[model samples]
Target: MRFFGIFCIVAILCCDLAAAESPLVVIVHRSRHSPISVEEVARIFLKKQRYWKDGAPVVPINREARSASRRVFEQYFLVRVRSDLVAYWNEQYFHGVFPPATLESDEAVKRYVGADSNAIGYIAADLVDDSVRVVHRLD
Candidate 1:
């Protein structure tokens, strides 16, 4: 019984560690019709740039707060939280500039951005599929 408990604990820990360390990836719309570089992706995440070359309005979508995925994204891609990022957005929003939109779920983000020409988002590296094109990989 003790051995079984120890094994379960070890297995749980391994699963958690694996989740915590999952690599994050950035992706753009499948119909975007442009090739993007890491620098360009970084710019979009930081809200420094807002449009693709084809004049499509670029919308950046983010995960919900408290999600493990959100932590990874902020630690690697975005540099701030919604309240703070909103402050940053507010500064630009009034100027006719906008920050990336926030989405609640991976599925919603995937569906909206994957089908739209003006949307982009980041998700787990392994979760990327043919419906989305990876633009950046976070270490």
Candidate 2:
């Protein structure tokens, strides 16, 4: 029983450490732009600012609320608690400005952004590749 308890604790700690170390990166279609500022990225994700400078409608994609990347994006960029975001979105819905569409996994987000010229999304930095260009990285 003692060995089992110690093993469980170690396993939990390792998982937590891995999650903390995984960097989050904001990605957009490779053809769009590179190294966009964090503030602009935040505005895009928040739906406060729409349309890329070239007159293309910005399509922001989000990971599921409970995903690790989503948590980091909400806490760091959005700067609001989940409940407050819920309320904000509710208000936005009334105004016909819905929140960004959510995908189940980072792979899906990458694929979506890669396929759409105006789409942007966030994912683990390690998952980034030539398919998408990273605009911002959050450690």
Best by TM-score: 2
lDDT of 1 by residue, 1-139 (tens): 9999999879855654464576777777776656787667768877788777877667878766556666777766555666876687678878887545677556667777778768888776666787887777777
How does candidate 2 fare on TM-score? Answer: 0.82
Q: Write out the backbone clash pairs for model 2.
A: none
lDDT of 2 by residue, 16-128 (tens): 44644789888999998645777887788889889888888999999877666788888988888989899988999999988899997788899999999999998888878
Q: Which ten residues in a row have the lowest lDDT in candidate 1?
A: 12-21
Cα lDDT of candidate 1 equals 0.71
TM-score of each: 0.66, 0.82
All candidates' lDDT scores?
Answer: 0.71, 0.84
Count the clashes in each prediction: 0, 0
lDDT of 2 at 12: 59
